[model samples]
Target: MPSESPCSGHADVEGKVGPESSGGPPTTLHSAPQNSPAMAQLLPSDVKMLLLMSRDPGRYSTVTRRLWGHIFDSLVVGSLERMALGVSQLMRPQALGPVIRATAMLYFHLCPRCTVQHYEAALDTFWRPPVKPPTLVFYSYDDPLCDTAHLQELLASWQQAGMPVWAQAWETSRHAAHLRQHPLEYRHALITFLGRLGLVAPTARL
Candidate 1:
C-alpha cells in the first residue's frame, strides 16, 4: 500500500500478472468473458484500485505508501462520492504536496529493484513482442515525478521488441494532469487513437 505516483497505467497489485490490454471499448463489453484470456485474468479488486488511482491520485492518503495500499483496498470498494472527493482535492496544493513527495520516494527506490528483476521478468515475458490490443502512451516532459529519458528508454525497448505502441509527449504538463490542463486535446487524442483502433465509436469524444 505504498503511495504511488500518477502512473497508475500499470497496475502492480500483489505484484501479480493480470490481463493484457486490448483495443476494445471497455463500456461495450458486458463481462470479462468478452476480453482476451489474458485480459479476463485481471483481478477485479486490483482493477478497481488502479482505475481510482489513475483517475485521481488524491483518492487515498498518499502521505504513506502502506496507507495508500490500504486505501486502495478500502476506498476502491467504497461509495462513488468518496471517489469524487479524491479528484476534487487534487486542486488543493496543501493537500497534494505530501502525497507527491511520498510518491517520489517510492518510485526512486522501487525503480532499481524493478529494473533488475521486473524488467527482465514481467514486462519482457508477459507482454512480449507485438503487444496485443496496441498501446497509447501519454507522457509530459514537465512531469516532476517521472524522468523523460528513462520513460523514453522503456518506450524504445517496447518498440524495439516490436510491441505495437503509440506515444504522445507534451512539452509541459504536470504529472497525470494532462487531462485537466488540456482537456480538449487530451480527449481528442484519446478518442482519435482509440477510434483508429476501432475501440471507440466514431462519435465518441471521451
Candidate 2:
C-alpha cells in the first residue's frame, strides 16, 4: 500500500476549476496506470530519469532551468490559485507532499490491472499553456543551455518588446537549480527582487 498525500485522503474528491470553488480542483490527479508499460515506451529514458529525479530532493538540480522556464499557465493559473488561496485550503508544505502522493495514486491506481488511460491523460496535459507573469527570470551568464544569445533574445523580447517579465543573470547555472546549489545567493536575489515589488518579507507562506 503506497502512502497517501494528506490532501488525498478523501473518498469523493472533485476539484473546482476556479477561485470561487467552495472546493479545490479535483483532489485527484487522474491518469493512466504506471505499470502499463506504455508510458515507458513513449517517454525516452533520459526524460523519464529527469522527471523521476525531480521527486527526489537530491536530484532536483540536475536538470537545467530552461526546462522549467516554459511552464506557468496550465498548472499555476487563476483558477487553481484562487482555490489554493481559499481560507480553508490546506497548509502549503504539509499538503504538498501528500498531494503529490495522492495524485500518483490517482494515476497508477490500476497498475496491477494493466491500464494506461490515466497515464496518457497526464501526458497530454503536462505542458503549461502560454501565459506570462510579472516574472523574474534568473539565468547564469555561462549556463550552457541558456547562454548569452538566449538571454539576449529574452531581454530584448521582455524589455524592449514590452513583454511582461523581468530577468537577472547570475554567474552560475542557477536557473531552477540555483536554489538547490547556492541557497544563500538564491535567497538574497529572490528577497531583493520581491522587495522591489513591495512584497518584502514573508506576507504568507508561499
Candidate 3:
C-alpha cells in the first residue's frame, strides 16, 4: 500500500510499497508502479529484486492523460446549488452513493493543480532510467483500474530496455487483490519467482 500522499512512501504491505528482508540481500516487493522510480533510488545497493502488481505508470502517454482529463471533467461538473441539493438529500439511503461521489468530485475539483503535479511526477518517474533489479509483474486483463493495453506496453518497454522482466496475466482479478482473489495461483507465481531469484528454497510451498 502507498501512503495517502503518493510522494511520501513506496508501495508495500505497510504504508510503503517495498518490504525488506533480513540477513541477506534485501528483496523489495512493489505493489504500485507510480512510486517505483523513487523506490529505486531508495533501494539498498544489494537489493536487486522487485515485484510489480497492477502497475499504474503515471499515465505517461499524452492520449491517456487527455482521456482521463476529459472523463474527469465530464464527471465533476455541476452547480453549487445542485451539489448542496445532492448533499442535503444524503439522509436518504438511495441518495448516499451519489452524495459520496459528489464529495469525492468536490475534493478533486479543489485539488486540480495538485493532481496535475502528481501526474507529471508520475510520468517523469516512469521514464527514469530503469532500475537494474530483476522484476516480476502481475496484472489482469479484466482489472477495471488498470488498462491492459497500457500494462502490456509497459512490459514491452521494460523488455526492450533490456531489463530482466517477467509478467503473469490473468483473465480476471481485482486490482491489487490478486493474492486474496486467487490465492493458490498467486502463491505459485510468487514462490516460483522467488525461487528463481534464490530468495526461497526450491522446496518452498505455500
Candidate 4:
C-alpha cells in the first residue's frame, strides 16, 4: 500500500476525488484493474507507466514532480515558475540521506504500479475553477513538450465549458521561459489579461 500524504489520506481511493475544499478543479480520476495483456495495445508505454504508478501511492515523491513538470513544460507557459513551485512543495529536509532519495526515485521509475495518483488528485483539487474570473492561457509553438493540436483542444474545451478564456500562442521561447524570453510581450499579455479581470487599470505598468 502507498503512504498517504501528511495532510490527508482520502485522496485517490477507488471512487473518491478528494476532500472538500475551496481549492481548484476536481481531478479526472483513472482506475487500473491489475495487469492486463490488453493494456499494452490500449496505451503507450509511457502512459502505462504513469497508470501503473497512479494505482500505488508509494511512488508519489519520485513521479509526481516529473509527470507534472512534463505536463507544465509542454504547455509552454510559466514552466520555470511551475518547477520552482513544485520543489518548494516537497519541503523535505536536506538532511534526509541521498541514498533514501535516490532509492525512492529509482523505485518510483521502475515500480510495477502507480502510487502517484493520490498526489495527482490532491494536487488537482488545489485549484478550483473560478466562478467568473477572466482567464488567459498562453502557449508557445517552440515548446517541444506540448502538442499544438492538444492545446487547441484543451482551449476549446474550456471555452465550451463557459470559461472566460483568452488563448495566445508564441512563435519562440524555451519551455516556461516566456517571461524571460519576451519580457515586454509577456508583461503586455499579463496587463491585458488582468485588465479584463478588472484587477488592474488598463494603463497600469508592472
Q: List the residue pairs that clash in candidate 3.
A: 1-12, 10-16, 10-17, 11-16, 11-17, 12-16, 12-17
The order by descending lDDT is 3, 4, 1, 2
lDDT of 2 by residue, 1-206 (tens): 12223322111221211123333221211111121113232232332322333333233322322222221111111121222232112233645645644544454554522224322332332222122224455555544323356345544654544434545456754323555676675566556555554555644222
Per lDDT, the best of the predicted structures is 3
What is candidate 4's lDDT per residue for 84-145, written digit by digit as tens? 33223223564554544454455435532342343334223213222222446566775543
TM-score of each: 0.44, 0.34, 0.54, 0.45
Quote the lDDT for 84 in model 1: 27
The lDDT of model 1 is 0.40
Model 1 lowest lDDT segment of ten: 68-77
What C-alpha lDDT, on a 0 to 100 scale, does residue 49 get in candidate 1?
38
Mind sharing the TM-score for model 4?
Answer: 0.45
Winner on TM-score (2 vs 4): 4
lDDT of 3 by residue, 24-66 (tens): 3343444332211122322211111111212332321222222
